[model samples]
Target chain A: AQSVTQLDSHVSVSEGTPVLLRCNYSSSYSPSLFWYVQHPNKGLQLLLKYTSAATLVKGINGFEAEFKKSETSFHLTKPSAHMSDAAEYFCVVSALNYGGATNKLIFGTGTLLAVQP
Target chain B: EPEVTQTPSHQVTQMGQEVILRCVPISNHLYFYWYRQILGQKVEFLVSFYNNEISEKSEIFDDQFSVERPDGSNFTLKIRSTKLEDSAMYFCASRGQFFQETQYFGPGTRLLVL
Candidate 1:
């Protein structure tokens, strides 16, 4: 079984400042982790995914996440936040489905990021 | 730059009415999925389809819910009877063989049962 936990429900950052959204996961196997962003009235956009590749994975919109197996954490971060970066971010963990490993995503509750100028 | 497209951005139906949500997955993707997100809640997986068959389904995908690939290009989810609890955003997703685990989502259909 796999589950995702987003530590923050809301985060506010000033424009051009750094942003951080914490996430943790519990999985019995080598899990595939991802970060997705959903803007207002828009569809979910994939940020990045970690599948036993690089520990630090870079994604679109200058965002990135580091998969720390030691701590069972995959936190999303950005060096500079833009006004457009305000959105709802979800942390997802994927595990093999019973019988054949179809892989289903277990999503977090989501964290709302707010950018202030 | 392929995408999964969904129909009826918004739909309003009465209780006990039936509704079908349609999706056209990205061409060449081998796996397709349906997920739902209730208002202000986490997204939950409903079902996954592949090879013209259902691979796996969640507890929420009961007998009242069924999925089908009526044509080569389109996949649909049918709800036999709409309930107030069925109101939510339904998203269609697909993943190519290359990105076997990275599923891309569609714009989603908002179903409102009254």
Candidate 2:
């Protein structure tokens, strides 16, 4: 049973301010964590992924997230927010099947971020 | 970089009618997958395909759903009967062989069951 919980359903931030979207997970094994962003009327784009290589992972468009094993959390952050950063974000965990292959992605309910100009 | 692509960006269908959603995965990728997100709901996995067969499927993938890679490049998801609950944004994804961890997704097809 693998699950991801995004703490906030909606987050409003001012332009040029810092941004944080909290996410926690429950996994039976070492999980592959990912952060994806869905722009309005657009497809999902992978922001970052953590697969035991590095605790701190950098992603596209000035986004990054840290995998905290102790906290069971992978929270997305940005030093400064732009008007374009407003979108829906999802925390995903990959589950490996019996054949030792990554099967499906369990996604969080998602947090919608709104940037105010 | 190559990416997955899906057809019929929007589709409106009557209940009980069959609908086939099409996808064209990355040229060299070996794995294909289908996922759906109901309005304001979490994206859920429907099925995964590899080696010309289904490798795994979720509980949400019931009898009404079927997948096929009829050609070398096309992968399709067919719903035998449409339901109001089936209205959602369906996404198609594909992953390469070596970097099996990352799955690139398509723009998605918005299906509206009336």
Residue-level error in angstroms, candidate 1, position A20? 0.3
**Candidate 2 lDDT by residue in tens digits, B1-114:** 788899989999999999999999999889999999999898999999988889899898999999999989999999999999999999999997854459999999999999
Reference contact recovery of candidate 2: 0.68
Question: What does candidate 2's lDDT look like per residue over A1-117, in tens digits?
Answer: 889999999999999999999999999888889999999989999999999888999999899999998999999999999999999999999887877464689999999999999
Clashes of 1: 0
After superposing the true interface residues, what Cα RMSD does each candidate give?
1.6, 1.7
Error of 2 at B85 (Å): 0.9
lDDT against the true structure, per candidate, is: 0.93, 0.93
Q: TM-scores of the models, in the given order?
A: 0.98, 0.98
Tens digits of per-residue lDDT for model 1, B1-114 = 898999989999999999999999998888889999999999999999988899999999999999999888999999999999999999999887654468999999999999
Clashes of each: 0, 0
Stretches of candidate 2 exceeding 4 Å from the true structure: none
